[model samples]
Target: MSDDSSMLLDGLPVAFADGQTIMEAAMAAGIFIPHLCHHPDFKPQGSCKLCTVKANGRYVSACTLPAKDGMEVENNSPDLNDKRRTMLQMLFVEGNHFCPSCEKSGNCMLQALAYELEMLSPHFPEFYPDRPVDASHPEVLLEFNRCILCELCVRASRDVDGKNIFALSGRGITKHLIVNAESGRLADTDFSLADQAAHVCPVGVILEKRHGFAVPIGSRRYDVEPIGMQVERPATAGTPGTRDEQA
Candidate 1:
């Protein structure tokens, strides 16, 4: 497939490649689109509706929808923006996302997206779900209370790391955390400290040991700007300031 085929997104003519998804094409064309589960290195799960776009007047997940020639895609329309904001709000209230206490406050994707949409407060009431925190691992912690269940970590663990240590256990609002193979803690599971899932989390739910509170909130990565702004930058160059030796 050619890398420069013409397509129409939101009534605007744009160039797209045949293999790229709608989100990839729109982002390559400098269009700002919101999404939660669409990581560049992982397969598209299309679980999050935050990146929904109108293609030929039908709503579809931009992360999974391929950009075909002559397709009309709407990305930043007012209605879509509202829906994205609302979905973010639901995520905010569904978990224990207390920005004041979280170490990943500034670097968190969910927090950054909320700020991008100017979500000053959660419109929905808090779910206050009581979930257990898994800190049994020597180098990782899993705080189920703060999880938004975007599933990026799951995919990273399963597909990228070849470790099926993480999986969604329940259904709907009653959903809770579950370990792989058995009901043991992450430490007992097949999860290794080197798994890509350890770093793909969008929230503080999955934290690295000896790394929490390493950087102050004001000095964190997303403090400079929204994550969308850094998406196009080189990963190393765009990373937030870290106290680690690698930084």
Candidate 2:
């Protein structure tokens, strides 16, 4: 590969360092790439394909794909947009996303992305997957029914906090709740309020107990604008580290 540090992403040239991923590069260039699992404070797990983009004539997860010199990337192509819409629809049907009742309705990333894609109604039949609510902890609420399985909290717990508290269980459509350690309760687990996992949940599934109804609908950050437009990439640090380093 060439030693150049810039690449053309959707007709716009963006510069990136040697180790930056395509998602990071695109964000740095002010290109909005819709994502749920990729958070700046957490490690990139790439579980959700919402950030999928065409690079060098191939589909790749921007969160995991390394940006290469001279590589051509198409982020907002018709095909990709269609795929994203379909994916969002599937996510909508796969879980019980009742926005009106959700505490995180306005600030939720999933809702914001769905609105951005214009998913007014879920066209597919509801999965209606039965998932138990785990509200054992006094400070945390675990509503498995609303989880998209984006694994943001899981990754944040495991990688950033070095506390492997949250983990997904089962496989395929049967995939259900997350277990926190052997006891399967947040309180029983070694997780603390300080753990990044507690704050990384994109949905209202895992929420801080105190802030349940703190922010009303239509007043939250994502409610005003899509997360892509609301959040800006912070200045990159000169050190080598995980996404937490940048934040």
Model 1, C-alpha of 137: deviation from truth (Å)? 1.0
| Global lDDT scores for all candidate models | 0.77, 0.77
**lDDT, candidate 2, residue 1?**
44
Candidate 2 has a TM-score of: 0.88
What are the C-alpha RMSDs, in order, of all predicted structures?
Answer: 3.0, 4.6
Candidate 1 clashing pairs, residues 3+ apart or interchain: 10-73, 221-240
lDDT of 1 at 81: 82
Task: Report the lDDT of model 2 for residue 6.
Answer: 92
Model 2: lDDT of residue 210? 71
Q: Model 1, range 53-126, lDDT digits (tens) per residue?
A: 89899999999988898888888778888888899999989888888888778877788898887777889998
Model 1 root-mean-square deviation: 3.0
Candidate 2 — what's its lDDT? 0.77
